[model samples]
Target: MITKYLAILRMKYVEMFAYQLSTMVWMFGTMVQPLITMMVWMNIYPDQGESFVLYFVALIMVERLTSAWDVWEMDRQIREGTFSYQIVRPFHPIHWAIAENIVYKGLFLVVLVPCWIILALFIPSLRLHLSVTGWGLFLAALLLGAVIRFAMSFLFGILCFWMNKVTAIYAMFETVSLFLSGQIAPFSLLPPVVKQISTFFPYRYMIGFPLEILTGTANSHTLMIGFIGSFIWAVVLIVIISLLWNAGLKKNQAVGG
Candidate 1:
């Protein structure tokens, strides 16, 4: 399995570099919204400008690290009948999606971490000072966030077997996630009701939980709750994706028959 994964990673690395320009463009494009939100928050509360800077900068890092694009990829592949190739492979198709994610996010980390270090030198607000435990917990939450997001995307991707426009549906989900996942603003700044409601949804776990940990806003109680919530959502999403994969394969076979 390790050998297979290594090979897949190599292939994905090559594929990623093949479109190096496009990948660079997309990675930087995702930064714009968070930066704009940072500026707006700075304007709204000029006194809290440093806080907003830290929160939004951390938001960009956490968001990119946890982001998933499998839904769109699988939607197009399944719709155009290319996904069948993956279905027939010796390994599960989800593994390929997972490999792609690992490769892409690795690229993101390579670029973004150094950028953060550089920015922190000039902008004190971009600096982070976490203890060993805090760093460990942040990494743990980030991994969980990535898993939940990938599972959620794959779940909707497989829905393409039954629906003609799964991407559109996933787009709506992303639109909601933008606000609920803390992409639009820090959870601290959101209304009380929104913060409460975000707790019940997977969106918060996907990006907000990790950022909360990194930004030092989450206290002991909040960390406890965030880890538990993220774990529960990650498990739930993975199980649902498994169940849906079987059902979708049956549907796909029926159509092919």
Candidate 2:
């Protein structure tokens, strides 16, 4: 399995760089929304402009690292009957999606880390003062965030077997996540009720939890709740995906055969 993953990673890396222009375009393009959001927050609280700058820049990094587009891919593939090919393959189709995410996110970190260091040199606010343990926790939370996002996407993607509007459904989920997942503003700035509500949903665990860890804003209690929330959601999503995968495959076979 490790050997197969390594080979898939290599193939995905080559495939990603094959469209160098598009990859570059996408990498830079994703920054626009976060940058714009940063500007808005800066304007809202001019006194805390520096803080807003750091938050949104980190937001861009976290967002790109955790973003998943499997729903769109699976939607088109299943709709076009191309997914049937993957279904018959020796390897599970989910592994291919996971490999693609690993390759793309690894590329993102390589590009973004340097850009962050460069920016930090000029913008003191971008500098992060984190201990070894803090960094480790942040990375772990980030990985969990990525898994939650990927699992959610794959769950919605598998729904394409039964529903033509899985992409639309997933879009709705993403739209809601923008507010709940801290894309619109820092979760701290949200109303008390909203913050409480967000805790119950996986949206906050997907992006907000890692950003909280990275920014060093989470208290011990908050950290405890965040990890617990993330773990529960991760387990729940995995269970759902496993159940659905079998049902989806059976449905696909019946329809295609």
Worst 10 residues of 2 by lDDT: 248-257
Q: Tens-digit lDDT track for model 1 on 1-257?
A: 99999999999999999999999999999999999988999999999999889998898899899989999888778877888889999999888989999999999999999999999999998888899999999999999999999889889998888999888889999999988999888887899999899999999999999998899999999888899999999988888888888888989842331
- Model 1, residue 2: distance off in Å is 0.7
Q: What is the lDDT of residue 171 in candidate 1?
A: 90
Candidate 2: stretches off by over 4 Å: 253-257
Runs with alpha carbons beyond 4 Å of true place in candidate 1:
253-257
List clashing residue pairs in candidate 1: none
Q: What clash pairs does model 2 have?
A: none
Q: Give the winner by lDDT.
A: 2
RMSD of each: 1.5, 1.4
